[model samples]
Target: MTYCVGMMLDAGLVFMSDTRTNAGLDNISTFKKMTSWETPGERAITLLSSGNLATTQAVVSLLEERPHAHGERDPSILGVPSMFQAARLVADTLREVIAQHDAAGQQADSAFGATLILGGQIKGGPPRLFMIYPEGNFIEASSDTPFFQIGETKYGRPILVRAYDPKMSFEAAIKLLLVSFDSTVKANLSVGAPFDFHFYRKDSLQLDTTGRIDADNPYLQLISQGWGDALKNALESLPDFALE
Candidate 1:
């Protein structure tokens, strides 16, 4: 399990993902969950994934192969004309990859199932975000909902709902995501560190930041410690329930 979010903001796009994959109590590992493809000026596309690691990785590999498969050196996300088409291409390719794997009798539906949060911008457009399902269909994020999150979601969604604002600074947006990730990490062991995060400013057409955040990241430590202590202090200061 993991937690990955892609926020579509007026300023740009913010993406964050955890690198944990757990099979059992003793079987756990870390692998990157964020992938990006860009043409420097033409367009940029990012994929943040959660769920069956193999299936997600296979799908991503297939996406990267479009150009080669098409007998061209340049058919790719960066070549796609719009964020919409790029997402469709990802969904279609995911469906094909998963279906083929299932047909080979080498995997289970649940084991090959995965989900993605896709986001970025094309030359003439605003940033956009989409949630691609295991079935390879998806929906776009709108201003009414400026962000999309996947995996271990129920635990972390509330913070995003509360803190996400289109006008908020990019730094604030990431802080909000960290708070959200922290809450989920405390409640679920399947999602662990190190985390993958990337920031893409609108029209920049380059990765602003692509890095790993480990269990001991300073900001994360502060939130996990300071916030928990603050909550405890707040609860202790409140009147206790009367024994009625």
Candidate 2:
């Protein structure tokens, strides 16, 4: 299991994903769930993936290969003319990989299924974000739904709902995401750091910031401890229920 989120902001886009994958209590591993592509002044694309590791890796590999595969009809994410088209290409690739591995072919519940969050900007269009499913369909982020999450999402969703502000600075957004991720890490062993993240400033057509945050990072430690203390204090300050 994993946790991944992509947020659309007025300032730009922010993405983060956890690295843990496990088959059982004894078989745990860390694999990066974030993949990105950039063409400097032309485009900057990042994908956060969840679900079957093989399927997600295959989808990404195919996307990486297609641009250089001569006579390929489908453009790579890098070659796509717009973010929308790039999303379509990713969705198709995800569906194709799942179909190859599952007899049922493209079923969302198939053992080989994967889900992806695709976000970035192409040269001619405004930045965009999308959530692509295993069935070759997707929906773009909009004013009404300006963020996307895939995999182990329940534990961390509430903070994003209550605190997200589209106009918030990148610093603020990253802090918010850390708190959200900290909550998930506390609740589920499967979703944990070190987390990987990317930031793209709108129209920069290049990735602005990218890094990994290990469990020992001082700032993450601060957010985790501070948020817990704050939550406890808030609960204490609330009016208590009394049985009459």
Candidate 3:
């Protein structure tokens, strides 16, 4: 299990993903859940994944191989003309990978299923975000739905609904996502830390910033403690209910 989020903002796009994957109480490991492709000035694409690790890894490997597959180099993601086409290519690739592994019997359905969040910019189009399902179909984020969260989502969705702002600075957006990820991590053991994050300013056609945030990172620790204190204070400040 993991917690990954991608936000579509007026300033640009932001993404974050936790690195934990658990098979049982004693069987747990950390693996990167984010992958990205960039072409300097032409385009920048990112993928945040959840669900079966094997399936997700296979999908990413396929996409990455496109640029070097065989003796011929295909158009690949770097050559896609628009964000919309990029999303379609990703969906098609995901679907094909699943179909290839789905024949492994009943276990395949559960073990080979995966979900992804795709976002970025293609030179000619605006930045875009999409939540792609295990079935390969996806929905784009819009004004009404400006962000997408996958895996262990229920725990952190409320804050996003109440606090998201289209015009907030890139710093504020990262802070908000950290709070959300912290909430999910506390509620679910399947999700842990050493999160990976990235930001892309619209039309920049390059990744603006990217880094790994570990559990001991001071800023992350502050956000966790601060959010808890703020919640308790809010609860205590609310008007008391009186029974008539």
Clashes of each: 0, 0, 0
Q: What's the candidate order when arranged by decreasing TM-score?
A: 3, 2, 1
Q: Report the lDDT tens digits of candidate 3 across residue range 69-145.
A: 66655557766798888888888888887777776565524567788999999887889999998888999999999
Candidate lDDT (C-alpha), each: 0.84, 0.92, 0.90
What is the TM-score (0 to 1) of candidate 2? Answer: 0.94
Compute the lDDT of residue 80 as modeled in candidate 1.
Answer: 77
Model 2, 1-244: lDDT tens digits are 8999999999999999999999877788999999999999999999999999998999989989988898888677778898999988899888878877986454555889788999999998999999998899999999899999899888899989999999999999999999989989898988889999999999999988999999999999999989988989989999999999
Per-residue CA lDDT of model 1 for 78-179, tens digit only, reads: 567888988888888778877877887855445687899999888888788899997989999988877888898989897788767888887888778888
Which pairs, if any, clash in model 3? none
The candidate that wins on lDDT is 2
Shift in Å, residue 243, candidate 3: 2.8
- Score residue 238 of candidate 3 by CA lDDT: 94
How far residue 179's Cα lies from its native spot in candidate 1, in Å, is: 1.2
Over all chains combined, what TM-score does candidate 3 have?
A: 0.95
